[model samples]
Target: MTIKEKEEEVIEEFSFFEDWMAKYEYIIDLGKNLNGYPPEQKTPENIIKGCQSQVWLHAYMDGEKLIYKADSDALISKGLISLLVGVLSDQTPADILSNKLKFIEEIGLNEHLSPNRSNGLSSMIKTMKAYAIAFSK
Candidate 1:
């Protein structure tokens, strides 16, 4: 699917929860499904700097698309990363750079997260985009 279509799917999935509590629970559940990151890859360079929790993100170009994989010491953070990876992975770098990922706002994720977690989320996005930028060449 296109990135926008993937984003819309996320918004739709999140819409199933009427309250933030249920939403958070669902997010945690999503976190459980992440493919574990390789322990050896948890180096300083892979670590996202701004997170209160240790969040590790990695991305690379596969043909014309970017493939992202990540992990976090924190459950919620992992879920948040999963949400982002779901939407943004397997897409072109130019496409990723041009989109705002407004679905984060659309899902009210920004309002529900703690300030530190919010910053971590932003850092993760930045890290993924930075990888895309490098490989886009």
Candidate 2:
């Protein structure tokens, strides 16, 4: 399925969980399945700033869409990054630029996150947006 379709599916699945903890667990599990960067590509250049845990992200344009790979030292954070990337990857620059990831707030993760995590999340979003901007140019 397309990333957008998968994201909608996840949102639907999350809506089925009664407890917020269960939703968090589901997100973490999603992260566990993400394809991380190769050891060789794990460098400062690719590292995402503002995250409490070390996170690395890389993006490349494949035809009309942006492809992404990312990793984090912390398991839950890795999952968070994975979820973000999963939702945003494989999208064309214009689609990504116009799309708003309301799911973060819709699932109520934003209010529950620590200040640092929120900063990291913003940084991650900035990174993804920056990639789209650069590729579009």
lDDT of 2 by residue, 42-64 (tens): 99999999999998999999999
Error of 2 at 66 (Å): 0.6
- Deviation (Å) of 20 in candidate 1: 1.5
The C-alpha stretches of model 1 lying farther than 4 A from their native spots are: none
Q: What is each predicted model's overall lDDT from 0 to 1? A: 0.89, 0.83
Query: How many backbone clashes can be found in candidate 2?
Result: 1
In model 1, how many backbone clashes occur?
0
Question: Which TM-score value belongs to model 1?
Answer: 0.95
Off-target runs (Cα >4 Å) in candidate 2 are 1-6
For candidate 2, what's the RMSD? Answer: 1.8
Q: Clashes per prediction?
A: 0, 1
**Which candidate number has the best lDDT?**
1
